[model samples]
Target: MSEPRFVVVRNDEEQYSIWSADRELPPGWHDAGFTGTRAECLAHVDEVWTDMRPRSVREAAR
Candidate 1:
């Protein structure tokens, strides 16, 4: 089978979440702050994902 895909969604200031295409939000998906900037949020997301699994273009979608 192919690997899972994840989507990072920002809801409000200092709030964000991540989910898989075929699943609900995973643990630690929203343990970080939004920081009011795309770069900051993405950086935190990258850090969070790095601790769990490697990231790939195919694994992250809108």
Candidate 2:
């Protein structure tokens, strides 16, 4: 399996943020109702790679 890529995005209200681990996620995109503690967020990032699509080296390097 490949490693995960992560990006942080803030909600419209800017009250909280989510750390997305999928390579396809665009900048500034936010998911709803995805709250987690700091540690949970890190764990989510680590595990997300298992379910996320693998990115090519070129794609990842970009």
Candidate 3:
């Protein structure tokens, strides 16, 4: 069997996570236009999602 593929997804609050490429996405989340292996997906998230805080929290702070 082939290894599982993953897609990078982001929610309204700007949180990042990986989802199965073959499965339907959950509510309130959309694909970030990137697909790859689990590690690659995570690395993408790590590179982009530098702020761990939710969008609302970040906005409120600013």
Candidate 4:
């Protein structure tokens, strides 16, 4: 079997999630463009997804 591939995804609320590279992205969600093994993808999210709040909330704070 082939190795699993993962993609980091985010929604409008700024929630980060991992998705299968071979699976279809659901509506209203888009890829963050980070792809790799599950661990790598999660690490990417940890490095970049520092803020857990939604975009709107973050913007409001700014």
Cα error of candidate 2 at position 48, Å: 0.6
Tens digit of per-residue lDDT, candidate 3, span 2-61: 779999999999999999999999999999989999999999999999999999999999
After superposition, which runs of candidate 2 have C-alpha atoms over 4 Å from their true positions?
1-27, 50-62
Between which residue pairs do clashes occur in model 3? none
Cα lDDT tens digits, model 1, 1-62, are 84444456543232445544455545445433334344545666766554342344335642
Model 4: per-residue Cα lDDT over 1-62, one tens digit each = 96799999999888899999999998878998899999999999999989888899989999
**Candidate 3 error regions (>4 Å):** none
Count clashing residue pairs per candidate. 0, 0, 0, 0
> What is the per-residue lDDT of model 2 for residues 1-38, given as tens digits with 9 covering 90 to 100?
74444444434433233564544444555654344555
* Model with the higher TM-score, candidate 2 or 3: 3
Which candidate comes out best when scored by TM-score?
3
Give candidate 3's TM-score.
Answer: 0.95
Which prediction has the highest lDDT against the true structure? 3
TM-score (C-alpha) between model 1 and the true structure: 0.32
Q: Could you give the C-alpha RMSD of every candidate to the true structure, in order shown?
A: 14.3, 12.7, 0.8, 1.4
Q: Return the candidate ranking by lDDT, descending.
A: 3, 4, 1, 2
* Local distance difference test, each candidate: 0.47, 0.47, 0.96, 0.92
